[model samples]
Target: MNTPHTIVETTLVPHTAFEEATQRLEQCFSYADGASEPICIALVGESRTGKSRALEECFTRHAPIRQPDGLTTPILRVKTPSKPTVKSLAELMLRALADPRAYSGTENAKTSRLLKLMNESGVKMVMIDEFQHFYDKGSHKVMHHVADWLKVLVDDARVALVVAGLPTCRAVIDQNEQLAGRFLSPVFMPRFDWQDTDQREEFIAILGAFQESMGEAFDLPAFTGDEMAFRFYCATGGLIGYLTKFLRQAVWNAIDAKTTTIDLANLLRAHSEAIWAKDGPTGLPSPFDRRFSTAATDDLLARIKRIGIPAEEIRLPRSKAARQTGALGVQAVLTAR
Candidate 1:
């Protein structure tokens, strides 16, 4: 029986966009209730660039930026509303407020009630994710309305807004010039650029470091040259998320075979299975191409290699056969460099 070894949990990698966004996100939690003015931030990036993950971190952490005051900081996170209309948007706010008495009667009245709830709840920030749907499916009129409605919400609620979505979401915000002023900082997440040698090398170093770290637990060999790296770069356009998927798959295959070290053969086999990524392992691209991740590949892998994990040194089978044989205590994989 073969157990899947490729599946990794919480892969470690330095995603620049995610890192930069963390600082800006901290600002949202920094302000006190009604003490600071409103702020708005937009996350713009192509598919699979980790924009969603950056926004989702706040939700997963659930720790609001505490202010000088002892009061708990308030954070409201919501995805774009389905069937977004002035009415629906208002209702969405009401629901997220989780305050039953916040809204009542007609739309206008509900808006008033929602404003009251925001004030009453001391809500400091509102994060709307997947906001690009309106631009993708709705008309110009709908887009404009959503923009105007958001501005009004920001002013009335006196809370910051942090939105994350696809690059098309940029078009939606640009259309509403007023909205741009509201969100002065627009985070742009782009695919990894392989043309820059220094950048590529730095990324490689990170992966090498990681290899060292994991070496104690597993014998992952050093990745030499640009052959496989370039191949992965071409397929992923340097997208961190995509690169990780490819490398993880390769390592997984090597482990399953119980190979002493990862090599090009195992990598190719893994690439073939990554149909959504590079040309499949056999170098064939399927009709579909939709895969993504958030960490740069080379950089991430290098970091793994540098961690200097301790792996039990293996003796050559033939030479050691003259004596008793036994594999001993656990250790981490160490970096050759």
Candidate 2:
């Protein structure tokens, strides 16, 4: 029997966007095998759009194997370190390859070792997550050397490369012409938009799937009914991550209360504690509140759209005076030296 806790924690409902992304990743893996030139792809999305999950799903499909001589990793996945430099990025790849001297080698040494290991381990595809780290948020500059190094590494290794990150990470590729040319059409995982008819129906169906899962464990209300589904969409801003979080919290609440069923009250409690606590105040009424209006007003929709989207990139001032001032600072330091 599926317990509420287990069902909520372990279930991964595959939605349309997630399925499409995973399929593309699998295609990339197959195309890279024995290909004359390396295949490269970029997976870009906002946080919680299931980018990492899709990468993970594809990685599981190409699980590493152990032979008498050593381990053979078909796919190597590494997270890009924050504010990555070539040295740091190389070290990370080395560590993923299980190099004992991952931290000790010089950048060039590490790169050589990394390539050798990839060949020995039979690495066909490399998956890099958090690729936005290649673009420094503070300085608004792409780490060109790191991007260049990665491009060369994939080319030399003759392996497919899949880099997944926030939408801002696109700057890393856009700024590097060589890197840009090597990539396929980028795969995008976007949040579910309630305004779109197809997306709205898909979101409702996703809710129905969750409700069915929960129903197996406990008595569940008609969570997929029109009003309830709309409420859930409002609460989660149509992001599957937020919906899962909200549902998990509600399940936990039910278990804590020694209840065998979930109701709107449980959802209301979950909304107040789980969604608002992490996302901050949205000035909107609780979607689960019985008295709350379910009408989809334009004003309401506009505010909901901002729920899970990341803040806009910081725009650094670009002016002749600013450049001159920066140059003067560098010149003053150089003169002091």
Candidate 3:
């Protein structure tokens, strides 16, 4: 297990889209307190495209700046439950509202209580991440009801809803005309494209900043930002979560080995397990991680390396391999003629 020597400062950077979205959200408040509603903007994208993190930060900034009741509590942290719906969604609002009756009422009562709470709290916007789970209730009836329920609550409270999720989330909301109407803007989170020079530069800067934030215990040296960013691009195709996990794990693995340097070797080893490993450092972790073998992990890593490609992708085999690091735990090299 690798432990990160340095911590990462995730707050300093602001993704462009998130900044724009926040500005639009702030304007939603100018509408009548009870009559104006937020124009729902569906934040759709592939997994790990920086959508969730960006939205969270933007929303937190927009929330009322009041301190929470407890010294430890921070006001304006939006709530997202394991299972979301009209009733459960209501409970989340109640909890956000700190309403004691949050648990006292039946499901409908809870929903009603939350709408009342929303209006009282002046919550102009409600954002739901992982909005796709709404369709997973094992029945379409529940899905439709959840949509209708959201419509009613939003209409009643006159607040905007920002739903962030995979593309499938749009389909769910599309079923509700009113819900779809509320969504005037559809923001898409595209994977970081190395093809764009400007995006690539920003990406590298973020990596450098992350390294600095992690501090000296992190073995990663300050190199030309572009070099570090390009290296990660090859490994992860600029997948945000994958890139984050790989970097953090590389530092952690370096720490575990009592090493003071994070090089290609350490990065590759950590990258393999932290991302493609069944344990999945960040993504929906594979259940098999706890029971799988190194070979299984290797296969998964290779497969990820194979996506969007046919059987033609070259695999660097062990027989022609140059060397291996035991703690890094994986080794493969592309062959030269």
Candidate 4:
């Protein structure tokens, strides 16, 4: 019998796109003080595409500085509210700074306090995650007022801003001409493409890393195997986040069933219970089935593409959204710098 020495912690593999985006963000942060105008960058992608994970990694590298009098934060990261307004955004920052009176103020008063606190704290760069909330995707309405407020804040504060969220968030900035001009071209985090030769190679390399990390969790099917890799590509639709999840669940199933090695049955069980249950039953063919064909692959890919649309416009199974939020906790755990 074999068992893992340790559970798989949320592993952050610095893929190429993630590294490039981080470099761009670092440049923006470093350039803020000397530049005449404020620098802004956006990390846009679909959910589970590792945008938030990349930002979290960058944030940890530039952690707040502790001084004798008070803390001086060189980089401040805050989560945007689902319904973001000047007041709610202010409260988020205040709370992140550990201000005692985070919630007690009018919108104007809150904005004033936020700016004063930011300046006094010596914050040079601000990172806002889940920025898709800036617009009402369901209503197809842009929150132009909030966008205006953010533009003014950035100008007055003279700090660089890094915003990351689903691609829909791009509309929020695009709707405001000043913001559109200020935000440099967005860095997109894309999912794995099965059809691309290079992507397939890189993805297998990623899987190899996972195999190593699993230690003795039970021999996972070799990702290099043509059939095995195809099954994995089908199961996860090229989202590294989903790939980790499916593998994790399969390991757990093996453990509970006292199985010596993971097999096709274990994977199918995990897929239905862990991935499909939440992702909704779309009548997609199971990769484990003997009859599974390229037609099934095409259908699955189409569904994955639909998920990249604006968050509100896309309808998800209730459990799916909840599960996504839960999975984020694993991603939030930062790896070593």
Candidate 5:
């Protein structure tokens, strides 16, 4: 029997952008072998746009195989360490390859060991996530030396490289001429936009898929209708991560409350508990609130629109922001009209 938790956690609602990104990754993995030059790809997107998930799905298809000699790791995946240096990165890669002395080696020694292990483990493609870490957050500078090292490493190992991270990470490749020249066209995973007709429809379809999944366990309020879908968009800003977080919370809430159906009241409570912490409140009205008006909703959507791609520039509207002044200010701005 599948619990609501299992249903929500396991269900991956396919949308257009996500599907396209997956296809691109598959193509990269498939053609990695028998290529003269090292194949490279960049998967860049804002946080919570499913960049990591897409990589994981592709990784699953090429699972590691165990043979008489040793385990064959076809694809090596590692997250970039915060404030990554060449030494730290080499060590991290060694650790992923199960090196006993991953932290004990000198930089050159680690690099040598990494290459040997890559050959030994049969690693053909290297996938690095959280690649934005290559950019210094405080100084706003790209780690050029490290990027250069990676370029050389890929070239020497003769393995395909895929780096996934925030859109800002594009600078990591763009700034390095050698690296940029080696990469195929970048793959972008962006949040759904309400203003775009196709995106809006896809967002609704995603909600419908989630609703169907949850419906298997408990009756969920209609989430596919335009008006209701718009409300959900306001709540999650059309980011699949936020939407899944919100729905996961609703599922748990339903279980705890001993309810068979997730109603608007349940969603209101879930929004409060899941979307934002009680400590910090955004002044904005809860999209799930019965009293939340169209004007307020539009006001919220407008604010979300301002959060353009490369979401780092303007942080997503948080509950804390809502608790402070924006919520009341939005109401004040709306009420005056």
Candidate 6:
């Protein structure tokens, strides 16, 4: 089975949005070191649009610097708890700092330890992914207490705060004017635009890059072919994360079935089984059927290849509502008195 090999070959594909986000993060990282006040920046996007990945890439670039004094983490990254409470948030930070006794204290105690560790560890920046957890959507409440706590902690520490989360995170940040004012303009990582001439070429180039990276290993199908590329884009709704996911599964399926090549059929089956199997019908046309091909698809592809079109007039596919990444429970946020 090509399982082991295929798993190793799966890698991050750098497209336009990812690259741009990385550049902005680099600037943020540099600005954190000497800023007079704590710097805040929000990385906002739909789930699976690479917000977390971009933050992670920046974190990796500026890893902990070990010295005789101690290990100095330049960028401390952690994910918010699934159920966000003041206690849980403190515990998350403590755990990320490698404190064994992360869960051993009251909320106030944990908060003290969190701040102490951040200073002692020489943490210059903090990155919290899935930050939207701080807001409870079902109850329509913002965790004002937690937000105030964070604002105080960051100000005291004087470290940059890099928060990445879903679009809903904007609401959480907006509720606190003091917290919201600290943040620089948010960097939005949008999905690929199929109708935009430059974006389409860049998207296709990303597909070509993936094929070049993995094609020879498995005798993969022509992913960059005009029709195949359009189909892949449609299947993935132009999200690189989904595109990579679909391709990875298709590769594994090809290997397990002892097939020599990945074809449209393999991809179609992979789509139905993996991507949207549980979501039910999306009311969108299937990209797999030959009869599903239309003049609209052709014209879109034509515009993409030619890179000639009125930028304002070109009609692109509308984005579907953002999918929930996990099941949210019946919970309420603690508002500040």
* Local accuracy by lDDT, each model: 0.62, 0.86, 0.60, 0.78, 0.84, 0.76
Order by TM-score, highest first: 2, 5, 4, 6, 3, 1
Candidate 6 displacement at residue 137 in angstroms: 1.2
Ranked by lDDT, top first: 2, 5, 4, 6, 1, 3
lDDT of 1: 0.62
lDDT (tens digit, per residue) of candidate 3 on 178-286: 7777777777776556667777776776666666665555555563355445555555655666667666677677768887787656666776767543323334223
Per-candidate TM-scores read 0.64, 0.89, 0.69, 0.82, 0.87, 0.82
lDDT of 6 by residue, 1-337 (tens): 3343464235667877888888888887788877988889999987667888899789989898888988788888889877678888888899888888998999889989988999899888889999888888767788888889889989988899989988889998998999999998999987667778787787788888877766666666777777777777666666666777777777777778876576667878777766754222244456766755634465554432322111244556544432222212212222321
List clashing residue pairs in candidate 4: none
In angstroms, how far off is 153's CA in candidate 3? 0.8
lDDT of 3 at 24: 55
Off-target runs (Cα >4 Å) in candidate 6 are 1-10, 65-69, 278-285, 297-337
Q: List the residue pairs that clash in candidate 2.
A: none
For 8-125, candidate 1 gives per-residue lDDT tens digits of 3254455566788766777665753554557788888766677767776765565545557532437777788665667777777778766565445677788788787777667777
Provide the global lDDT of candidate 2 against the true structure.
0.86
Candidate 2 minimal-lDDT segment of 10 residues: 276-285
lDDT of 2 by residue, 31-69 (tens): 897887888888888787889988988998889898999
lDDT of 5 by residue, 1-337 (tens): 5677777778987777788888988888888888898999988888778899999988889878999998899999999999999999998888888889999878888999999999999998999999999998778799999999999998889999999999889988988999999999988888888988999999999989888889998987799987789788877777888788878899888888888799998888887787544212257677788876645355566676543233245566678856778779989989999
Q: Which ten residues in a row have the lowest lDDT in candidate 1?
A: 327-336
- Candidate 2 has a TM-score of 0.89
Model 4, TM vs. native: 0.82
Name the better of 2 and 3 by TM-score: 2
